[model samples]
Target: RFGMLETVSEFAGEQLAAHGELEMVRGQHARYFLALGEAAAPHLRVAGQTAWMDRLEAEHPNLRAALAWLLAAREGEEAVRLAGALWWFWYIRGYPSEGQQWLSRTLASGGSSIARAAALVGAGWFALDQGDVTPGLAALEEAVALQRAAGDRQGIATALNWLGNAYVHERQYARAEQIHTEVLALRRQLDDQPGIAASLANLAGC
Candidate 1:
């Protein structure tokens, strides 16, 4: 029994070293890694976790930059990526005021339509959350138009889904239905089964 316990302990030690559940990460992996960090921190030793984060930062500057933005409540491409890592991140963290600063900067500097469209969408969502329908609708409208102009069908569809939700909130069922139907058609055309399911669920909820 003692020998078997020693063997098991040795194996567990190897597993911990080989797979920390805190691998070095960057780019899109940043958000997921941070999420895992948050989820697993409670179960990990504090000193070990700090060492892991330090190692992660050293290996992945982009991820570090993203995490710094979140920690500081700052906003820019780096911060936006962190927020957009998942919709839940945005909901949980909320848009930083610094985001508006960057948005204005991007617009003034003549950034690409895609960038502008994304900023506008972010603004629209922020406004919606604040109960300002006019600004929200206007921002989303611009985002949808820009997305179409940029030939970003997926982005356009996403904007359409939000716009449809806005319409439903305003009790404009007919308009919402039109937008939702259009989204469904586009999802089908794209052969996106998951998207179709989401759109269907959205429509059913409305």
Candidate 2:
């Protein structure tokens, strides 16, 4: 099923390349192009990956492919799903500011609070990467609150992990430790191998 979708998407992309008028193909062509871009995203992380993403973004400049790839990777099942959600949140629009605005719009809605929380988490990370601490902390805190309200254990743990890093960035070791401790405990309970390794590494450094 997935492979068929990939092939269809790829074929559609090839067709789109032959004809610049996405409007000509309208519904199915446009949809297939988007699907193919996403389908190829995971494989794009290998050496030749950026070229495809670049091609997709250049052809579909109206879409937010670049920003989506920036926010999350297309690696592994869970990561891909998370990246897809991020892509949908921002990629329905354009780059950076507009993409963030679209993300904010979805977060503004009350439905899918968990998804909104995840969006905020992505925002927080983006802000921090840009060297803006205030907005980053604000977004991370909101994500933590939303995850808590939604009772999403996994989301809560992930938010806490990032929150701990934000705290550490501000030289608030105590607060960082508190959040990290919570993540560590949850990771232990879940027996998440990678999470455990990250938590242990953080603790060791602390």
Candidate 3:
């Protein structure tokens, strides 16, 4: 159930107070953040520019609290999972540097999942943007490998799409061309019109 806007504001006030050490309820604020985290995930599932992303941008305060609570509570892989949900947001919105920081910390915690693929992809792009192509490619390769083993078609395509870009950064146009061509085939097979368009654009850059 979505919390009313007014309810979220009230809860935020309470949480801010708790953080200020003015007052702290045993479970109220914690529960509020927990719920907020769950609530935020549906908004992130699309992983690109969308109305949901606009909503996420609007909920920065509450979203930050939910994410902060997960990390501060030492929630293990849950923290990783929570942060990984923002991979698209980070990549699309140009927060790769911050994404790398959070994901590196998460990966250092020995987290693993389908979410792990998201972390790797985020780290890969962040590293690539920083011009660390080797580690970037390595992370992306692992991400693609994971998606393949999991038989996740969409995930594989997503990883490979970026992996192709990583290759471009390395001046490996042959590899990038091949990867994009492969992506094109997959997109055609999947009848992913948008993906096919994207693949065409990627290939055009090659």
Off by over 4 Å in 1: 1-88, 95-109
TM-score of each: 0.56, 0.57, 0.73
Q: Give the distance in Å from residue 188's predicted Cα in candidate 1 to where it truly belongs.
A: 0.3
Stretches off by above 4 angstroms in model 2 are 1-84, 87-102, 108-111
**How well does candidate 3 match the true structure in TM-score terms?**
0.73
Q: How close is candidate 1 to the true structure, as a TM-score?
A: 0.56
Q: Which pairs clash inside model 1?
A: none
The digit string of per-residue lDDT tens for model 2 on 89-124 reads: 334234556545545544543335565666777677
**Which candidate order results from sorting by TM-score in descending order?**
3, 2, 1
Using lDDT as the measure, the top candidate is 3
Worst-scoring 10-residue span by lDDT in model 2: 70-79
Q: Pick the candidate with the highest TM-score.
A: 3
In order, the Cα lDDT scores of the candidates are 0.61, 0.62, 0.74
RMSD of 2: 9.2
lDDT of 1: 0.61
Tell me each candidate's RMSD, in Å, in order: 12.6, 9.2, 5.4
